[model samples]
Structure formats: structure tokens, C-alpha cells
Target: MTLYYDETGDTKLPFESLSIAETVIQGTLRYLESPYDAEVNLLLTMNNEIREINQEHRNIDKATDVLSFPAIDFEVPGDFSDVSTFDLNPETKELILGDIVISKEKVLSQGDEYGHSPLREYAFLIVHSVLHLVGYDHMEEDEKETMERIQKAIMEYLKISR
Candidate 1:
């Protein structure tokens, strides 16, 4: 898995030594057993910027912890059987999973509020967003249960706990 990472925010991350965000992302892909080599784009931004993006895209008018824009619409979550040739990157032949935007401010605040390290919160968010990229969603109760279960498993796999 390849991660294209970027950061755009005045608020720096609370934790200084957590490059494990990349590990969390790759771990998610492995946990799902993605059929093809995959790449993801990640952005670390501030709350206000994410809020504006959320408002523009989702029209929710609120700051979110993370947002995912998936490149493929799977017939079933994590089922890559139907992937097409078009989904692959021409140069690298890797599946373009999609993009993730995270709120750095939320990573700090939520970690403190939830009584966990920022690293843990950051890892959780990365896993959550990667699941979204693979077509997992929580719009319904059953789906929520499944997604949550998978998330827990991946977190355990990565040895990251709250």
C-alpha cells in the first residue's frame, strides 16, 4: 500500500512521535484483504477547513473528525471482485482507493476528551477512514455493527488500544 500524505493546518498534531498513522492505514488494507495493491491520499487539516469542506460536500455545516471520498462503489463492502481496469493507476497499476481528510484539531481534542493518547485517536481515525475508502459505511445499524467489528479487529491487529 502506498500513502500520499499531506498536511495543511496551523494547529500541529499533539503527538510528536506517531508516524504509525501510515501503519494504521496499511494495516486496514491488509485486514480487509484487498485484492489489489492500493494507494490512498491523506490530508491532515484544521477543523475550520474540514467544516467548510463538510458543508460544501455533505452540507452538514459542521466540523467532522474525518471524511472519506471513495474511488470505487463496491457492490458489497470490501468485495473487490467487481473492480474494473479503469480503477487502476496507469503508472503503478495500484488500485486508487481514494482520499481521506482529517481534522488535526479534532484528533487532539477528541483524544483528550475520550481519555486516550492523540496517537490512539489518530490511529482509530485512520482505520475508520480507510474502511470508508473500501466501501464500508455505517448508514444502517447492521452495517454499523459490521464496520465497528472490523474496525476493532484491525485496531487489535495493529496493537492500538484506547
Candidate 2:
């Protein structure tokens, strides 16, 4: 897996303690023993820029901790049973997963609220977004529970605990 990251935000604040944006591109190359080869891009932008994106895309004036844009449709493939395994890219050797957008301001605020470090919150957001990229959703109670369980497992695997 290849993870690509970009950050945009206020430089005045401590660089180590600011907002971040992470974009993950999954292809066929496996970095971890997971089913997908992924690339992650992280961007740290100012609160105003995040707010603009929120208003433009989500039409919500308030800032959010994370925003996810999934490239693939969630409808189970007809050959789902036949193809028990995921497909891989022959060229890139990856899965071409999707993208994830997050807000640093929200991370900081939520971290404080949850009594955890910002880094942990940020890792959680990334894990959550990656799960969404791979056809995970929490539209229902059961789905939410399942997704949360998966997220926790991934975080634990990565040693990112709260």
C-alpha cells in the first residue's frame, strides 16, 4: 500500500499541533496483509478552508471532524459470491480505493471532548474514512456497530489506541 499525504493550514501555530488532510489511494500493491493496497494523502488546512469545503459540498455551515467521498458504489456486485476475493490492479498493483477529507479544527476539539490526544483522534478519523472507502457504512444500528468494531480492530492493529 502507498499512502500519499498533503497538509494545508495555519503555519503560525505549532506545526506539530495543527490540522491535517489525508488522501489514500488504494491499488493492488499490498503494504500490510490487508485485502487492498492503499495510498493515503493527508492535508492540514485552516478552519476557514475546511468551512468553505463543508459549505460548498455538504451545504453545512459548521465544520465537521471528517468528510468522506467514496468512488465506488456500495451495491453488492452480482458476482459477489463467485468472486470471493477482491480484485487487484495489474499495473499499479493496488486497488484504487478512494479519498478522505478531514478537518484539523474538529479533530482538536473532539480530542479534547473525548479526553484523548489529537493524534489518536486523527488516526481514528483516518481509519473511519478508510473503512468508508472500502464499502463500510453506518446507516443502520447494526451496520454502525459492525463498522465501529472493524474500525477498532484496524486501529488496534495499527497500534493507535485512545
Candidate 3:
């Protein structure tokens, strides 16, 4: 798993704390623990750029915190009993996960609203986006709860307490 990340836009926003372009390529590879190669690319941009991206991809003009573009269309099993088990991609020996786009401006603003550090909020967004790349959705109440639980667990594991 290779996470390729890049960032664009102002680095000096009043509300912005940490504007970074981080790629968790090696960490993602280790987490997946599969012979398959999963590449996860992310572009963290400001609100204006994000708005353009959202319009181009999702046909929505509004800026969203995060957006995921998955390579595969398989649905994860409803049972969360085996969430630790990583999926494998047999063909290319790589899962070829997908891409994530986040808005730094959104993160900072949301952090203030949620009463948490910008780092914690950013971490949450990363975890949330990664989970989506791995086929997690929260359209339903139960699914939302499950996803939130998983996100919190990952955050705790990373020692990112709010």
C-alpha cells in the first residue's frame, strides 16, 4: 500500500494550524499486510481548490472535508467481527485502493467547531478517508455507528485523544 499525498493553497490561513502533504505509503503497506500493492493518493487542498475538485468529480460545487475515489466496487461484509483482517488483491499483487482529497481549511474550521486540536481533527479525517478507501460507508445508522467506532479505535491506537 502506497499513500501518495500532496497539498496546495495558502499555508498561512489564520485558522490553519498544520497544513501538510503526508504520504503514509509504508505504513499503509504494513497495515494491509498483503502481497498486493495498494496505492492511496491524497491531495489536501484549500477550500477554493476543493470546490473545483468536488465540482469536477462529484458534480457538487461545495467544498467537502474529504472525498474518496475507490478503485474497486466491492461491499464490505456487514459484520464488524473481523475488521482487523485485511483484504488482498490477487491479480496485480496489489489492492490498488484509491485516492482521497481533503480540505485543510475545512479541517481547521471543523476542529474549532468540535472543540478539538487541529491535529486530532486532521487525523480523524485521514482515518475516515482511509476507511472509505477500504470500503466503509456510513449511509445508514448502524453503518455510521460502526464506522465511528472503528475511527475512534484507530485514533486511540495512534494516541490521538481529543
lDDT of 3: 0.67
Which sections of candidate 3 miss by over 4 Å? 12-37, 77-92
Q: Regarding lDDT, does 2 or 3 come out ahead? A: 3
Q: List per-prediction Cα lDDT, in the order shown.
A: 0.87, 0.59, 0.67
Clashes of 2: 35
Inter-residue clash pairs, candidate 1: none
lDDT per residue (tens digit) for residues 10-69 in model 1: 888856423676678777887888778888888899989999999999999999999999
lDDT of 2 by residue, 72-112 (tens): 55454211222222444456666555556677787778889
Q: What is the Å distance of residue 52 in model 1 from its true position?
A: 0.7
The order by descending TM-score is 1, 3, 2
The better candidate by TM-score, 2 or 3, is 3
- Worst lDDT run of 10 residues, candidate 2, spans 23-32
* lDDT-sorted candidate list, best first: 1, 3, 2
Residue 47 in candidate 2 has what lDDT? 71
Best by the TM-score measure? 1
Instruction: Tell me, by lDDT, which candidate is best.
Output: 1
